[model samples]
Target chain A: MTKLLEVKDVVAGYGDGPAILNGASIDVQPGKVHCIIGPNGAGKSTLLKAICGMLKVRQGSVMFKGQNLKGKRPDQVLREGICFVPQERALFPKMTVRENLRMGGFSMTDKATLEKRIDEIEERFPILRERRDQHAGTMSGGQQQTLAMARTMILRPEIVMLDEPSLGLAPKIVQEVFDIMKVMTEDGITVLLVEQNALMGLKHADWGVVLDLGRTLFEGPAKEVLTDPRIQELYLGGQKAA
Target chain B: MSDLIQILILGLALGGVYALMGAGLSLVFGVMRIVNLAHPSLIMLGAYVAYWAFRLYGIDPLIILPVAMVILAATGVILYKLVFEREARSAKYSEMTVLLTFAFAMVFEGALATAFTNTQRVTSPAYATDAIFIADIFIPLGQLYAGIVSLVLIAGLALWLKYTRFGYAIRATTQNREAAELLGVNVNFVGLVSFAIGLALAGAAGALVSFVFSFYPSKHWEWIAILMSLVVLGGMGSILGTVVAAYTLSVVAAYVGFFFGATWSTLTFFVALFVVLLVRPQGLFGEKPELA
Candidate 1:
């Protein structure tokens, strides 16, 4: 598998603060679901943020498709085929669903191409078509999550970085979100997901990286990591796989 | 009665200019959460620009509106780059902007004082005192023209915000900055452009004010207080609210002037503002204040 993105010992933090991501590193392969699971404050979200240019990287580098993404702004990162869906509800709440979707393609200057992409997206996510004029904030949690995912897809990005896609979601909605990830990987898009739900994340992902206190504890096939006694004890409350 | 109709027309005309002034102030506050105390001074600058354009070039202040807008927009861009840009991303942004813009206002006021020397000035055209009577209600030509121009400009701004791509970016940034950035918006660019547009609106309003009222550099302090009251009554960051509050308060002030005296008319703005603050601190249409 070809490496789509490579992070090398990246040190990052908020201003004048201790490092949240202390020398953390990971390689994400193309067309694969790479999940990073960790306990609170383990810097899973911060790692994703560092790669996407939301947080400033103090040291090391983020390489994507042979280009160094170290100092590029978030919009520049999006232009370079990477889209980040933040943990918070990232929709412009007052804007209509269609407006939110159009804004997702903000980098695209060609109106024809943008409209075509929206049409394609609407066909796949029929709910988006049905509620194109409705405000995104009024939608249910699952529906909003789906819309958020669809909004990023408008750019046809090669890599999607999701920060806790299932955070604060119901179990059924969580399952729906994971299914969307499956759909993304099947469509030849690489996904780098930061998930707090370790068990579900590991089960659905092809590769898993266990993060503990800003350092990688284990990196391997998701099934192997899931079955590992140490990960089972630390993350899964010692619950063995059925 | 004809008397009530005349007062209503006068109130609306005054309200139109206030709307133009308050809109820009409200927008800057909405997008960046910055209370730009320098806003009225910027309007004063626009007035001065219009004053000079008419005084030197023999151009109508009405025709000079676009020229004033461009100059003020450029000034806004430079001001954002020089002063506000660095502090924008800091934790102390809101607090810092108040002091920074207050200082900017003082410097601007001082510069105008140096240039124009605090003498009261008015742009009196050939038709400055011209009036048209309709059904025994007399409307001054300057106020009528300024009122029409203000409404048109305000409508144009509203349409731009609703229809254009840049408008969408501005609205998105206003709604959620991080979300806008993540969705490939150049938020810094949006900030620069929005500030420019806000000041441009101020410029347009200032040009109109030059024809309608006598002004000097120091007049901005009083104007700032009145503009702030309008914005506060309308709710910070709400364009529709600002326009509504402007008309409502102008009419109220007009009635007070008719009933009591012109001096008491000026006092009405502060009285209404205080009552609103005590009863509904968020203003008429404002949402509950978000914890910063």
Candidate 2:
């Protein structure tokens, strides 16, 4: 019911480059899925980076549980219960699926706590437990996406930020992944999903925000944003929002 | 029989040093995706450090091995921060690392030559000559020590990479640098430490082998042939592969020396490498090649 994280007018970019995210803000509530959909180069991934401290926050603030997330590193943000999965295939190819999961909990020290968390994660993503000994790279693209999600869940975070989890996946596998996202939301894990696949993302999401050229163009209920013609014109390439 | 066994012992000991040197090369290539050509020079520099330790403090070459590793590790970190890191990140990739390390090696070789004469230096302590005989096999005590130390250090490094936090970070980055950074890994920090750790292994190898063999300024060029062969035969970037390759080469060289002539032993080593490469270009334990 309460706000878990607040990205208030956050401005950020890489190196000494120009700000890619300008005056962007979003609030994620507990047990909510906030999907950000936009065309490529719209600062969607950059927004996720700003929240997780991968990029420098040059203006405004990111508050997680009332703690300023501005200069904290990605691991520290993860320690504070926020885990991020980038748009890239982030799994370590040489390591087994189980090893990758344990790697997600690298910052976690307590053995019992890690074991308990792994038990919980493996239960949700049965594929991970089924192929625990399999190398992450050996799995199918869709399966690798599932394993990546399971890897983050091992961290036992309050929020999981995903950047285009459905990219490079088959239509059927994409549906399966969306089902996993739904399950994640039902389990009370807040998700901030950045997607280019708009319709499916909106249907699976509780809330939706459309970003365009480094700024928030629209925000509201998923259905409402889906019906917004301007959003459809911009992101759907002038096609009707399916 | 006695002559053959002595040759085998000598070959194995030398192979252990080759493995150590190859391990460092493999680590740098594995983690940073760069071939460090000057790694041999770093090894030479390490030998100098050991030579100094023995001459000045009378510390045994065995004792100086770890100390030289630490010093070389520091030097490696500084070099990575200064040259290799930025260049490797550029569009040039491995070529930049090769050029930088080659330059560094030249400087390293020049400095070593300047610091001491180019003549060979043999470091020996009071017990360096002691040997143990089991059945008909004779093993020089120093050679045995170097071999054991090499194995132990390699095992220690392997265990450290498997179990430690920094090890996980290194492994993660080696898998995917950009993604690892997104997960909050300090890529720069990991790169620095990995570079240092990799070079330190080379340094230790240099010190150990210098004690066993006569050390000279340009011996790195000689070792490069064997070292590169071991790496290519084992699969570059695989530490375990390097060990396996090293021993394989050692056995081949020993037998060649025993059966044919000692002069052709090095040629035999190169031949074995070529055969292996023809069969498996990726090396014996190489990772599956991704689409470049």
Candidate 3:
């Protein structure tokens, strides 16, 4: 199958800083959850930033659906059907849930279509509908995370890149997040996830990309990488695969 | 009893204009993270616009308000493009903007001084000296009109922010700029338009100021301190906070002026501001500081 999105030998970093992603690359399959796992400072999140045009790409190219996205602005990238949800989940704190949903489809000019999409989102996440008038910042973590994921769906992007979706959630909430990942794929959206919970991430993903020292070390089927002795020893707290 | 009521009424009117000035400053800071030290100078310029239009074209200051707003909005575009935009890319943007705006304020003050001289001027329309007596509480028509316009404009802005698409983008960008960009909000455009709106608000307030108070080029030096106190008291970058704080402080100042003297009125502003800050350093509506 053709790759839905490809990042080839991309070098990127923050301003005046050494490249965090020296030459990281990944291939995302359509309608599959691809989790990137690595140690601290491994450029997992940086790779997502480079692809989504948040961070400047010094070299290499990001091709989505066979179009170059290297120099595109973040807004331009979203127009091309890619959305990124950073670790902070960047919700408008003072705005109501309904208002936040409206912001999600900001690029869409038609009010009817925007409201329709918001209705669809609210239907899928009933909690959002219940708290539609409540301020987003006041919502609990799990609810906010749900809203973040749901907000990305407002654009109906082909690919959604998420950085640390499970960072601070409880185990039950983390399970719910992975369940949402399942729902996303079932809805025909590809998910590119950077997760610190290596074992849990691989368990939920269809494929796994291992990043080390600002580069993609290797990638394989999720079960293969999960059970690999080397990966288990280095990242999964040294639990031998049964 | 009537004297206290009179002071309260006049204080509320002054508060309305203060809210307008504070809203402009807060919007600029909220959206672009620019303190806009040039804010009061822009207001002074707006007063001059009202002054000039009334003097030259025989236009009523109220009738010329929108024209002044447009001119000030254009001035905002030029200022942002020529000055603020370039400084935005720096690592020390916050600090740089403060200094840059301060310099811009000086330049504007000097330019106005050169063109119009340091002489005080007021826009005297037919109703400027008229007063409405309502059962022993006489209300100056000019101040009452200015207050009504200020409150109406503020309500319009509040509705715009709540109901409009661009307004949604602005609120989102104010909350999280990167996230807004990710969601396809043209943040640079939002920044430019918001900065323009901020100046337009200043112009509106200035037009009203001309009707009620005498102003000169250097008068902004005094106004700047007052405006800054209002913004700080309301919480930096909070429009609602600024409005509330403006009304509260203005009322306190009026009360001080009524009881003590006119000189104590100005001093009351800072005193009230400090008292509030002493209680809530983050500001009246500012979010509490988070641990790193």
Best by DockQ: 3
Best by TM-score: 3
Error of 2 at B37 (Å): 2.8
Determine which window of 10 residues in candidate 2 chain B has minimal summed lDDT: B83-92
Q: What's candidate 3's DockQ score? A: 0.91
lDDT of 3 by residue, B250-270 (tens): 988999999999999999777
Error of 3 at A24 (Å): 0.7
> Candidate 2 lDDT, tens digit per residue, A81-185?
998898875888888887787777777778678778877888878888899899888889998999888777676579999999999999999998888888777
lDDT of 1 by residue, B124-240 (tens): 887778999997999888988888899999899889989889989998998899999998899999999889999999899889999899999989899888888989998888888
- Candidate 2: list runs displaced more than 4 Å: A1-3, A8-25, A56-72, A237-242, B1-10, B77-93, B126-137, B256-264, B267-281
How much DockQ does model 1 earn? 0.86
Superposed by TM-score, candidate 1 places the C-alpha of residue A192 at a distance from the truth, in angstroms, of: 1.0
lDDT of 3 by residue, A1-242 (tens): 77999899999999879999988989888988999999999999899888988889999999999999999999999999998989999888999999889888999999999999999989988999999999999999999999999999888899999899998999999998888888888889999999998988888889999999899998999899999989998878896544
- Deviation from native of the Cα of residue B239 in model 1, angstroms: 2.0
Local lDDT at B143 for model 1: 85
Candidate 1 per-residue C-alpha lDDT over A1-242 given as tens digits, one digit per residue, 9 for 90 to 100: 67889998999998879999888989999988899988899999999889989889999989999999998899999999999998886998888999999999988999889999999989988999999999987898888899899888888899999988998899988998998888888888899988887888888888999887888878999999899998889988887876
